[model samples]
Target chain A: MISVAVDAYGGDHAPQEVIKGIEFALRENSDLFVYLVGKEGELKGFIKGFEDSFRKRINIVDAPQVVRMSDKPSQALRLKNSSMAVGINLVKEGKADAFMTAGNSGAAMALAMFTLGRIKGVSRPAIATLLPTLEGQMLMLDVGANVDCKPQHLLEFSIMGYVYAKHVAGIDNPRVAVLSNGSEPGKGNQLTLSSYDLLSKSRLNFIGNIEGDEIYKGRADVVVCDGFVGNVVLKVSESIPDLIIEFLKEEIKRSFWYKIGFLLAKPAFRVLKSKTDYSSFGGAPLLGVRGSCIISHGRSNGVAIKNAILKAVKFSKEKVNDKIESAMEGCFVLKELKGAVRT
Target chain B: MISVAVDAYGGDHAPQEVIKGIEFALRENSDLFVYLVGKEGELKGFIKGFEDSFRKRINIVDAPQVVRMSDKPSQALRLKNSSMAVGINLVKEGKADAFMTAGNSGAAMALAMFTLGRIKGVSRPAIATLLPTLEGQMLMLDVGANVDCKPQHLLEFSIMGYVYAKHVAGIDNPRVAVLSNGSEPGKGNQLTLSSYDLLSKSRLNFIGNIEGDEIYKGRADVVVCDGFVGNVVLKVSESIPDLIIEFLKEEIKRSFWYKIGFLLAKPAFRVLKSKTDYSSFGGAPLLGVRGSCIISHGRSNGVAIKNAILKAVKFSKEKVNDKIESAMEGCFVLKELKGAVRT
Candidate 1:
């Protein structure tokens, strides 16, 4: 049975939703076990609400402190007895196969790096999030981690994203492209321009540069960019559906006929919402780390948490970290080749 | 009478839409006269198709060359006899009040800088595009002008964007903000982190940092960023409706009920499209230059071209350049104070 560490006191709807998510995940996957890490007294009450069968699969690990949302990563790191740190420790101590949290993202990253550590040959770990597009879903990496990146960092991200998309996303020879201002090979600023040359020469299926407008057109399986640019793109795309709905609400209020049309078109709107919904993807995987760690949305509910647990289960089973390490070996040889070409 | 220089052979629709746009602008504003800059024979043929009364207001300048979209800005600059150059020359000689083009944006910027030059105290010019939001329209600058910008350049953009929003956009004391990964002050990469500090002490109504998602939330009247981030946001937002509509089309085709709902909600959809349409705002203005220049879409139709011409007229009449020059002076004084604080 696969074991997963769950930060039971992480998200906005913690304890309650975290307990519910554990139950939901246990129901969906029979061959799974969970170590629910949180305050013993608070979790015991919610644990009592669940059935005996679910309680049998779950084990509570006592963690006295909680990491507040506003707490800095440095402060959270000092809290050795915190729920986030204890859960990550379970993964490090071989008590769990993966760690899942919806709590302070920076803290989670810090704990993962401090505990399980980065994969061999990986300089920095990155967060990869899935975005919805017309052609289906595409993976974008460095969403909020590693704000300032060099050309080599982006090259590593492309390799890591390629491995994740291939093994986890289940695409054969995933098409990888760097996010740029224009689609042309020579386009983009300093970082993307140098990364483009490296990505093109790498062993992965690099498909040159892709413009921002082409992202939703399902152009590439994996799109690579700096964390700052990727974060902006992710946030902008996330806000589109809500902004559209808000605009439509105002438009419908203006005329009587439009109101009736909106009522009838509610199903179509539901479909659009489902396509762009975050709950379906569950969490963003902190790629390049030694162990599987999924950081979920802060506002995530039971369903989102459950989906994240399922994703963690799949990621552990895929042995993506092993593949990432090997990919970096190949990347090192390519770097040598690039150096040779320069001389 | 206000004389506007129109590039007859610039966009995909070329001399045709250019002439139609001139006709449309002339009809809209009686005080407008157009210098149709293109090959003499081609423009005269189109001008001949119009009535004698309309033809009287149109003057054709013989320019035998055209700047291809693929040509480099440097290469286009060498084409002294090109329509883009001829049109900009008209503005330089005071033969035209403002210049309008649907040509290569880089070429247009280069020509404007090469001919009219930057305003006094302005480090570099920027392109400002108006975007639709819940709180009506807001302006975003440096869309694609300077891909790599310093803290000082962004500070200049904020000043210029502030002046344009105040004068042309008609907002009193517009709320100006810098775009970052988060709304907090210390939440961006190296560039935005320094820019946040600089913008806070400027003379304009600076409102700290804003995230990408908050842009459409009607958070600020003028949003500033490096051209790269601004371009990506502009293109992504511009493509959102198309992607949504494409996704909706597939969803509607999946079921009969959805198809009917879409048909009924067609009016509401029209309202949504009109609100987000770029044609409504005419075109992006190349701000901070010595003279007014409007860069329209390459795929501009007659209506879009006409609106661009009208926008150029208003921009010139408003004397936004004069205001931009003065704004930069205020910015210089503020920079001195900042430098003094450092010492």
Candidate 2:
């Protein structure tokens, strides 16, 4: 049985939505167990409606404190008994196989880092997200974990992303590319230019540089970038579908024929929406941390939370951390740097 | 009459579309004169059918050399007699009010900087493009000029963007913003954090940092970013409409109803396409240069080139260069740096 620790007092719709998510997950996986960490009084009232069988799988670990969305990382860390903190501690202490939260992403990342520590040889942890592409989906790392990344950090992200794509996402010999302003080998900022040199020398399937426009074309399975660029790209991509929808809605309201066409084409739009939906993809995993830590969107609903829990379980069962450790062993830059240090 | 030099042997669809664009522009603006720069033999053959009256407005300047899109910036500069070079030289020699090209952007930028020279006190010239927003349009700068930038460069871009928005775009007291990973103060990488500090002290109507997702909301009239980030944002934004259409096309093929719905909604789709069309927006201007220089897309059609020509005329007539010069004179960071140098 895979036990997942979930922060109940997290996300916009806490306790209720998180409780519903736990129930949904429990129903989906009979062998799954949950340690729902939150205020006991609030969580108990919400979960009272669950079936006796579902109740048997759930253990409400009382933690009265709540981490507000606006709380800074330092302030959040001080909230030692908060649901987000307590839940991550559950994973650190080996009480749960993984931890899932739809809380403040920065706070969650900080708590995970402080509690779990970094994996051996990993310079810094990265937030890896699965973005939908024309073919299927691509894994992009350093989404928001490290705002300022050195070339070495990007290499580490590439390594972690390679392992996740190979083991978790099941892509054989995934091609890795550094995100840049241009696709040519020499076309990039100082960061990417230096990164290109390092990535080219690495043993992985490094495919040189890829521009922003070409990222959606599924040219590379894993795209590595600094958190600053990746974060902006992710947010910009997220807003496109909604912006298009808004444009379509306005157009539909302007013409009678368009309204009819939209009504008839609703099914097709539904399919598109589902395909681009972030919830279906589950949560973004904070890679390179010693434990399985998945951070969901702050606006996550029951379905999104449920999917995140499922993803966390799978992430733990797959022993992705172990695979990452082994992959780092073969990293050329890491070894070279270590050798340089020895001299 | 506003005389604009046109590079006939440029872009993907060259002489044919360019000649067509000149014809279109001549038809629209009675006072517009074009100095067509290309091979005399090739261009003369294409324009033989033009009415005698329209022919009076066009002056053919013979230049046998062509700057291919693949040519490097340094190589392009050496092609001194190339169509792009000659066209820009017209503006340099005061033979034309402005220059427009649908050729290589880097080539155009390099030729403009080399011939026309930078505006006094301007460290680097930037390319500013108008992006469609929810309300109207916003000007984003340094789209692909300098891949790497310092904090002061971003400050210069903001100043130039502000001047263009106010003078050419006719935005009243344009709200200038620095694009960053997060919206809050101090929420950015090293570059943005420093830029934020500089922008806050500047005389422009500076809004704080804006996130990528918020750019579409049209909150800021002018958005400033490093060319590397700006170029990626531009390409990514340009690809969205096409990507969405591709997604829709894939979905429509799956069902009979969707196909029929798409056919009925063709008009509305056409409206959306026209609204998002890059051609309608004309071209990006190489701001901070001594003379007006406009760079259109490589795939520019007749309509795009025509619009670009019209835009170049407006940009020159508005005296955007003079306004940018004045704006730079008021720059806080530049003044402080000069003071430091003196000390």
Candidate 3:
């Protein structure tokens, strides 16, 4: 049986959407148990429609305080015993196999790090997202996790990303690439150029520098960068569909002819869009931690929150953290990369 | 009469597309004179259909050498006798008001900086491109110029972008924002946070830090960042539309119903697409220089070439160079941000 902990007072929709998504997932999933952490009364109202057996399967952990989306991440732990922090504590104590949250990402990461700690030899943790590409789904790491990072941090991200894609996404011998301005070996500034050198020398299959255009090309299974650049790319990639959909709505509605085409093309558009949809893959899983954890979008709807819960369960089945720790030992990678030249 | 120097041999299609676009523009326009720079012999085939007045209005300045898109930008001055270089020289020497190229961006900026020199107090030059956004048009600066920059460099880019949008796009008191990972007053890496602090103290209508999602919101006229981040955003933005179009093409061709919609809604789609076309804005203009210049895409078709030439003319008329020099007085705004907190 897989046990997953859900932060009830997490996302913007909170207990309402969270409870709905969890109940929806419970229809055919009999082996799964949930520990919903939030105020009992608030969650009780949200879970009103669930059957008694389903409600009984859900173990409630009292957490009255909620983390606001806008709250500073640094302030999370000090407001100790918060819903998000308490939820993460369950994973650390092994009460749950994996913890999932749609709360403030910064606070979630902060509490996860402080509570669960990191996998041995892993200097820092990284959030790895499976980005849909032309060739296949690629792994991009540190999208929002350590915003300001050293070149070494990027090298570590590549290792974690490569391991995730190989173990979780089922790609073997994943090719890792450092995101840079140009494709040339020496084309980037200090952060990228140095990271490129280290990544190239690591045990993983390392491709040279990759431009932003090749991001969707699946040129590499692992594309690593600092949080700032990665976040910008993620936002731009995510928002493009929203922007296109908005433009199409105004265009198709303006005329009868276009409306016919939009209807016919809707299925194909949905398929292509579904490939890029983050919900299909659940949430960005935090790698390099002692325990498994997944961070969902703070504004995730019912469909997305349900997927996040399943992804957390999958993390337990795969034992992703164990594989990452073993891989680090066999690959004394970063030490061997000290002689590498950035340019 | 505005006379624009057109580098006929600059882009991929060369004299054919450049000549056709110019001829097409001339048939609809009467107040413009064009200096077509290339080998006179090469222009014969493409120019055969136009009348004498059209031919005379489009004068050929014979210069044989064409710069390749792959050539090092630093090597631009060594090829001073080439067609691309000579055409731009005409602008600097007062023979033509502005210079435009569809051939190579690096080459164009190198020649523009070499011939025109930097405006006083401008350490590095920048290029500005108008991105289509939901709220309205947003001006992004340093699209290709300085790959590595200081916080003050971004402050200078803000002022230049602010002026360009105000003077050319007709936006008043154009709100400026430094691109960052979060909207918080102090977020992002050291570079963005510092840049934000400097922008906050600037004379331009500086707004606070803006995340990538808000970029398309059209909340700010000038969005400032280093060339590295700007280039990635610009490249990804440019590639997304083509990617979607490719997906649409494959899907529409497979299904009969979707095919009908593709035809009927085709016109509306075309109009909406034309609005997003970067060529309509001409080219990414190299700013902070003493003379006007426009850098076109290397893969530019005939229409893009013509638009680039026309945009150069507009830059000349707007006297963007002189105005940029005036904006430099506010360049020292970063000094006010020197004591900013590291955290």
Candidate 4:
């Protein structure tokens, strides 16, 4: 059984949605086992109606402390018995194959780094999330992790993204790119310019630079950027569909014809909405951490949570971390950087 | 009469659309005279059928060399007699009150700085463009000028944006903000952190950091960012409407109901398209320069070009450059930086 530790008291929906997610995941994956990390009493009460078959797969782990979303990472780190911390600890202690949380992303990353540590040769862990592209999904890294990243760190993100795309997403020979203001090699700031050179020299199928507009075109399988830019881009992209819908609604109110048209086109709009929906993608993986750590959106629902659990199981089963370590070992630039640092 | 220098050979539509734009602008403003700089023979051929009254307001200046959109800024700078260069020269020599182009933005900035020079105490010129928000519009600066910027540059952008918003855009006590990953003061990279401190200490109506998603909410009148981030954000935002349309089209084809709905809502979609249209905004102003310069999109049509000419005239009439110079004088950060550099 691929055992997973889930933070039940995390995210906006909290213990209720998390319980539903665990029940859904258990029904789907017969071989999956879960340690529901939260207040034991609350979790037990929620699962009281579960059948013997479902109950057999779930075990409650008492984590009396709850980390609030607004709490600083420092404050969260001190709460060692928090659900998020306990779930990560289960992975660290080899009791669970992976850990999933829809809680405070900052707290989750802090705890994961503190408990699980970084993969060898990885300077900083990055959050890798899937963005919908014209052709398929593209993985974008450092979405909210390392805000200030060196060129080497970006290179590491590319390697991790490449492995994830190839192994998990099932893309063959993923094309990696540095997300920049312009697609041209010379058309970036100091950081991207330096990163472009490092990426070009790497063994990964490194396509040059990709502009923001080209991101949705699916020209690159993996797009790497500093956390600040990635986070901004992701949030900005997320805001677009809703803004369009809002604009459409305002326009519809202007005329009777528009109202009728909107009603007919409602199905198409629903499809468009579902296609751009964040919940469908499950969660972003905190790549380069020592264990499998999936961080879902704070607003994630039961469906999203279930998908995240499935994704974590797949990640653990594929042994993505081992592949990343081997890939880092093969990277000459990383070796050179390490040599320079040691000297 | 407010005389304007028009780069007749710049942009995609060139002499044809430019002549039409000149005609339109002349009709809108009786006091406007235009110096249409381009190859004399080609420009004359296009305007041969214009009525005497319209023809009287235009003067053709011979500029044999043309700067192609693909040309590098350095390459463009060497074309001393190109339409873009000659037109800018008109402003530098006080022959025209303003210059407008739909050509290479980098070339426009380089030529404008090289010929007209910077406003006193200004370190660099920035491109400020208006973005449609829920309430009205917000001005975002450094869209594609200086990619890499220091905290002082951001401070200068805020001051310039503030002045423009107050004087030209007619916003009272404009609220200026630094764009960052998070809305919180400390939630940013090294650059934004330093910039936030500088902005908070400034005399402008400085609001705290605004995230990417919050940009469209119209919380602040002016948003300041380094050109790299701003360029990416602008391009990414520009791509959204078209992407949504593409997704909607794909969905519409999947069902008969959607097709019927799309036809009915076609007018509403058109309204949405026009509202999001870049042409309606005319052009981005190259702020902090000594002369009034407006850089239109390369894909500008006659209507866009005309609007840009009107905007340039408004900018000149408002004495924006003079206001920016005075604003810089009042800035303590710029004065302190200058003092430290002198020592």
DockQ of each: 0.63, 0.58, 0.51, 0.66
TM-score, each model?
0.93, 0.92, 0.90, 0.92
How does model 4 score by TM-score? 0.92
Give the distance in Å from residue A198's predicted Cα in candidate 2 to where it truly belongs: 1.9
How accurate locally is residue B240 in candidate 4, as Cα lDDT from 0 to 100? 82
Model 3 regions more than 4 Å off: A330-335, A338-343, B12-16, B19-22, B25-29, B37-72, B77-79, B82-84, B249-256, B330-343
Which candidate, 1 or 3, would have the higher DockQ against the true structure?
1
Once superposed on the true structure, which residue ranges of model 4 sit more than 4 Å away at CA?
A13-16, A41-55, A66-75, A331-343, B12-20, B48-53, B64-78, B331-343
lDDT of 2 by residue, A9-74 (tens): 889888778888888899999989999999988788888888999998989999999998767778
Of the two candidates 3 and 4, the one with more favorable DockQ, higher being better, is: 4
The stretch of ten residues in a row with the least summed lDDT in candidate 2 chain B is B334-343
Residue A275 lDDT in candidate 4? 83
Models ranked on lDDT: 4, 2, 1, 3
Best by lDDT: 4
Query: For model 3, what is the alpha-carbon lDDT of residue B132?
Result: 81
Off by over 4 Å in 1: A12-20, A66-76, A331-343, B12-16, B46-48, B331-343
Write the number of the candidate with greater DockQ, choosing between 1 and 2: 1
Tell me how far the alpha carbon of residue A212 in candidate 1 is from the true structure, in angstroms, after superposition: 1.0
Worst 10 residues of 1 chain B by lDDT: B334-343
Q: What ordering of candidates by TM-score runs from best to worst?
A: 1, 2, 4, 3
Judged by DockQ cut-offs, the docking class of candidate 2 is medium
